[model samples]
Target: MGEPFYITTAISYPNGKPHIGHAYEAIAADVIARFQRAMGRDVRFQTGTDEHGLKMMQKARDLGITPKQLCDGMSSYFIAMCDNLDVSYDVFIRTTEERHHTASQELWRRLEANGDLYLDRYEGWYSVRDEAFYDESELVAGEGGDKLSPQGTPVEWTVEESWFFRLSKYAEPLLKLYAEQPDFIQPDGRRNEVLRFVEGGLRDLSVSRTSFDWGVKVPGSDGHVMYVWVDALTNYITGLGFPDETGDFANYWPANIHLIGKDIVRFHTVYWPAILMSAGLALPRQVFGHGFLLNRGQKESKSLGNVTDPLELAERFGVDPLRYFLMREVAFGQDGSYSPEAIVTRCNAELANSYGNLVQRVLSMIFKNMDGTLETFSSAEADDVLLATVFAACRDELPREFAAMNFSGGIDAWMRGVFACNAYVDEQAPWTLRKTDPDRMRAVLLTLFMAIRDLTIAIAPVVPTSASKVLDQLGIPADERSYAALTGADWYMARVATGEKLGAPVPAFPRLELPEDAA
Candidate 1:
């Protein structure tokens, strides 16, 4: 056990089936959680479907199904997506659950008791597509001269009796929060965007809706359901067993980070923090707004007919390969595009050719040339240098970059270590040395064996399945695969003491071929 670490992905609104964007957020959050665990943190990761809102209600009506039926069916797909993608979430929360309703109502009562809530009327531009309300100033003109939200979603004017939260009162406090804790909202660009939005001034937000009842009911108020954002944001605490304010809630109430898409930054960073403040709860440590995943340079959409099913991609290319490609191709805070060709090329070049081939070759030589035996060997300056390079990448560079959420940059550093190993193998030519100088050949192969273990452990958080296969073949114990084990000087001697020998190796990441029709 280690210090408690809590991370969450934005609850996906399940008005539709899971999309690439949903998979992207879920996978990225899982990577963070896995990485934290590898770094010796006791991590709690939560993700789920936000099943209540006007969108879900209207979508259910259009499909002629009950809202609960729609949520039950649609949320299953998201759960499947997370499972299929190997997202190791600890909790999967559904807002429709009775416990979540209780948690949300208690949060509402706290806000009311703080004198921040009041009955009011809301008449403004709202985007059901975005599940957000916008001021008239935030609207942009569409091609047809219609008003659109900043996200370009169509907005509709609505008037309803509602309950409002005193968001206007939190502007100064929030600005102070941002100024004092610069990392409170991640990616300097997103923080600056929020700074500008808050500087302009905050408005009291409608916290309850009277139009329809597809949300948590406002306590002691009839015909008023808590606003969808209010309910949705509460899911983070609800998963921790809030309102009870004990056990997990007391331990993890202030989430380490809320990993969400950029479109929802205002809600998480602005609205979410204010609500928590009013309730006298600790604010989350950070809110990270990650950029979208695009389909070959264009945003995927139904109208464009370019929507991709992430599971299909995972099936085409192996799951580990797809996972590797995403973290390698995308800069964490910036938009990145992907295609069938991109997936095949990136995975084959990096996972298969670089790291995977390194593992296969090193282990194969140990099985053949070294008689599958383990022994202590002397290392030359070159072997020492190669091991140093790999160790630094695994221990120093990757961990530092990952701590700052720089996935691609960390992978880049790891690749340099891989490149160094390949160059070492080519220079050493252990195959030729096997006939001429058997002892040096044994040393070379064994040195590579050491390097392989470190590399595999460092990357396991990203591609867990394939990494595990390689580790299993290497005879590394399951419990010793974490980053903490990377520096153990006695692990090799301990293994040698066991007289464990290598078996013939299998390719952990076989090369992927693009389908003929994929183009």
Candidate 2:
């Protein structure tokens, strides 16, 4: 409705190779971006790596490489993964990039100018693994009575001279903002958590770290660098051209949505907005903290050796199916498990049996009987009913489902059309009609063709390759392949060129074979 829709996935920490969890988030965000674009909205999708963090520095040290080298190498892998996943991101912003550092420093300067930043001595429990400072109340007793962070990462007491942001001063203002915009932080539970945290009390946030030298250097400060969370959080604005308010920045600022994991809801909902308010900037419209992807029964992590490699999965199973499973298997804002069998089951049931079979059977019937041309289907009553239903699904039902981010529900509605068409073909018995009533057979085949064309367009955002294959089979020209065209009957009248051979139906989703003992 407005100029364009802008969405972003939280820039991932490139401490290690990306796993299925990372791929899941990217695919989810990409689906939303693609759907909005298909609805004729200009869409800007942003995703990238967060390279400046304590964990990243530690990872660089472990790899015996410089931080830049490690980040560059790992960031490349993430970019390749996005490509493999068919994620149409507009820009990839790395925290180590000059643009990002410049933006981060500018944000700091704005906060400093507003008198929100001050030098202070910090003494608290810090976790390098978590890149977070924990209060004593948050630490739990570990084995041998050692204190552990809530994340189960070890913690140690640290004292340093750090710059602190006046987060405590903005607590009341943030609570008021949250009350004014109840939908600002999504999924109710995440919002409640943030509200409760703010209600309890707010503490001054350490914005700079004197210990980490691998981060953005604080403006006018030689020994201190901006903290990783503060640096990484600035990327949303930086990617849009924050400080200068340039054309691109002005065009996409006040991002429509920020898609992040549930683990970091605090930084996004609380700290990030507080920083923005301190700098006299508008907060993003929505911050949706989607849940994690669990492996074996626990959260996926490097130490557990349970992390699923996204590239390997893409290579084994096609990218579309993997992308489809990620969105289809779980509700967008809930934690879900990943098993090879679950992926295979969804592909076989939804893609192969439901969608793919319907298209193949319809096209095969048309090719054999009418030579793939339907001149006058509008006159037939049965044909009109099927066409009406398919159009309703594509034009009304699917769009509503997608608007609510119910991707699986949207695909299910589209699948209902597929199933109904299949049943209609069987009941009409086109093969019998071809001999007894040639005119009836033409109507039936035409109805099937229209249904196939509409369903393919509806599911294109989820499975582009397979949808394109359906378009090729229908002889629909590239120009006619759009949501608007599919919803109207005008596109159906376009003459199908005779003798154009349809491609052989290769299995869109082949069954996955697993060893008996593997599960």
Judged by lDDT against the true structure, how good is candidate 1? 0.93
- CA lDDT, candidate 2, residue 222: 89
RMSD of each: 0.8, 2.1
Candidate 2 lDDT, tens digit per residue, 1-519?
Answer: 436788999998887788888898899898888788878777889999999877888888888999999999999989999998889899999988898999999999999999999999999999887788888988999888999998788998999999999999989998998999998998889999999999989999998888879899999988999989999999998888878896777788889899999988998999999999999898899999988888755887668867789888877767888787777778778888777777778887878777777777777777676665557554477777888888888878888898777777887788788778878888999889889998878778777877888888888888877677768766778777766676555665554434354544445545555546447
> Which pairs of residues collide in model 2?
none
- Stretches of candidate 2 above 4 Å error? 495-507, 510-518
Model 1 per-residue lDDT tens digits across residues 1-519: 899999999999888888999988888999899999999999999999898889999999999999999999999999999999999999999999999999999999999999999897899999999989999999999999999999999999999998999999999999999999999999999999999999999999998888899999988999999999999999999998888889998887689999999989999999999999999999999999999999999999999999999999899898898888899999998899999999999999999999999999999999987779989998899999999999999999998999999999999999999999999999999999989999999899999999999998999888999999999999999999989998788999998899988999999999899899998
Single out the weakest 10-residue window by summed lDDT for candidate 2: 496-505
- Residue 355's lDDT within candidate 1 is 90
The per-residue C-alpha lDDT of model 2 at residue 323 equals 81
